[model samples]
Target: MKKKDKSHSHSHLAFDHVSFSYKHSDKFTSVFDNINLTIHEKEFVTILGPSGAGKSTFFRLASGLEQPESGHIRLRDKEERHRLGKIGYMPQQDLLLPWRTVLENGLLPLEIKGMNKKEAREKVLHHMKKFGLLGTEDHYPHQLSGGMRQRVSFLRAILGGNEILLLDEPFSALDSMTRYMMQEWLLEQWHEWDKTIIFITHDVEEAIFLSDRVLMLTHPPIKGEIDEVNVPISRPRNEEHRSDAAFMKLKQDLLKKMRSKERSL
Candidate 1:
């Protein structure tokens, strides 16, 4: 694990002593208990855990889809009361409107913001090539491959013009080769856009490949603290780095930890 860099001191998002729970059928189930977490600006952070470990719940809280029962969620060092629409979010599924063309889907956020149709189209068009959707403007969701659909979904998320994005297993549905290619493409986009990304995934290798830090939520109903490891590998990582000795060791360690946590549950 790498040491925290002093240069990256400023946190773009933070959860301060936050607690949350859900009520179902006269039963209240707790998810978080006084948890504190900090994500730095422009950082690539991944949350890894077993199923039912509250990973989705974490994202929901971060994106403001659900609020904490106690404590605070801070954006840019200030607590934000209404966080919905303030942060971009891409769920596991593409969630694209099948009836809308690629161009129209990508323009949804900007349009919702009340930007003029002509200006929104211009803005989305300017980014089509960057998002690898230049020629598919008129294509519908069904006409595009899984990878392309994800790109369109991502484009829509970013069009919201937020500095932070919450991506929930966005590439988990793609084939292995396509998933790898999309991972590389995502890094390029992250570099170009300079956005802080909080990604959730069950794949250990995926977490190691894309994140500066991997946060592990071992068991459900988390209390006070969470485990984390910083990826020591250098930036501009590629396929070659996956085979590096450190990468392999880290992967093994993370897998071991995950397995142990699962067994404990």
Candidate 2:
């Protein structure tokens, strides 16, 4: 995250009584009713739940990929169905162009936005160095490790110039060690960029370790619901934080919520 001046102030992002369901669905829906949440400026929030808890649906609503049946989404002073381009989205897969080099992949978003090659390369180099992908800029995606490829994907997302990031299980595919390393890098970048991030994960531990707050969702089509757990650990959280009492307590609470859903089903 880029450092801002001492006096810089920004409005917190919010979801105000938002509700949604698929367009052709009947009463059976993916999500609906008063789903309210708020993320303070530069805050890191995690959305956690078992599969089918409507996590993806909620993200779609937040990303303006889908519209809510009713209610408003307020970002600062703006409202009224805005497609927030300021948000960077990274889905489960990296979604890199196979033929593109690391640098080219990082600059993909800029290219699509009509930036010239020179301008795009400048932004790409900036993120490459910031993200520790400097020497591999000329390598192809397949030539990099899983973790590095994900890094390139993240660089591309950041190059989109979105301050708020919506990440949906972005590191889930990697091995445990790689996943841990990626999580560390993610927090480092989050601190450096100072961007507001909303990350979705099924991993309770990851949620506790990475977020200022964890929103635990109920089962499918969750509505008017949340178990908002605050993580009070200090910044730049690491493996040690995982064994702390607060971390265990939050993890247990989240597990209980997930187990409840399992039983109900």
lDDT of each: 0.88, 0.78
Any runs in candidate 2 off by more than 4 Å, and if so which?
1-11, 24-28, 112-116, 129-149, 261-265
TM-score of each: 0.90, 0.83
**Taking the tens digit of each residue's C-alpha lDDT, what string does model 1 give over 2-121?**
333536568899999999999899998899999999999889999998788899899889989899999999998999978877899987677899999999999899988999989999
Off by over 4 Å in 1: 1-6, 126-136, 142-147
- lDDT value, candidate 1, whole model: 0.88
lDDT of 2: 0.78
